[model samples]
Target: MLGVRLDTELEERLANVARTQGRSKSDIAREAVRRYVELHDEAFRREARRQSQRASRRDTQEDYAFWEQAEREDAAWR
Candidate 1:
């Protein structure tokens, strides 16, 4: 079981919100934690996808060789 210690003022705010929402403190805390984790996980996933796309845009040795050969052929025509 995990335990959290909140300052008195913070605890009071949480308690008030829980009362207003008609939720148990533990339930509210769990939902809040779940949403926080999900939000960050989604952001992390988006960044990872962007990083992969950036990496894929870079040239490989095979691509360089192919392009170089194509340039040489085009130069012969010039």
Candidate 2:
């Protein structure tokens, strides 16, 4: 249950669109909000995935470096 305030000009535009589309302004607003939420949700998911991939790559590189150093130390002992 949310109330939105639109300016006079915008209100008229919305009214015209609603009249032509044979739909209520509330319906149009609801669909717009739904799409907005979905778009941002997908963007958030993509960023999270990218961050996870970056962290995984960093961890893999660190592990490789550690093993390489260990190998060098072992060769020196031999």
lDDT of residue 44 for candidate 1:
100
| Cα lDDT, all candidates | 0.95, 0.95
Candidate 2, poorest ten consecutive residues by summed lDDT:
54-63
Query: Across residues 1-78, which tens digit of lDDT does each residue of candidate 1 receive?
Result: 779999999899999999999999999999999999999999999999999998798778878899999999999999
* Model 2 lDDT, residue 43, Cα: 100
RMSD of each: 8.7, 7.5
- Clashing residue pairs in candidate 2 (N, C-alpha, C atoms within 3 angstroms): none
Clashes of 1: 0
lDDT value, candidate 2, whole model: 0.95
Spell out the clash pairs found in candidate 1. none
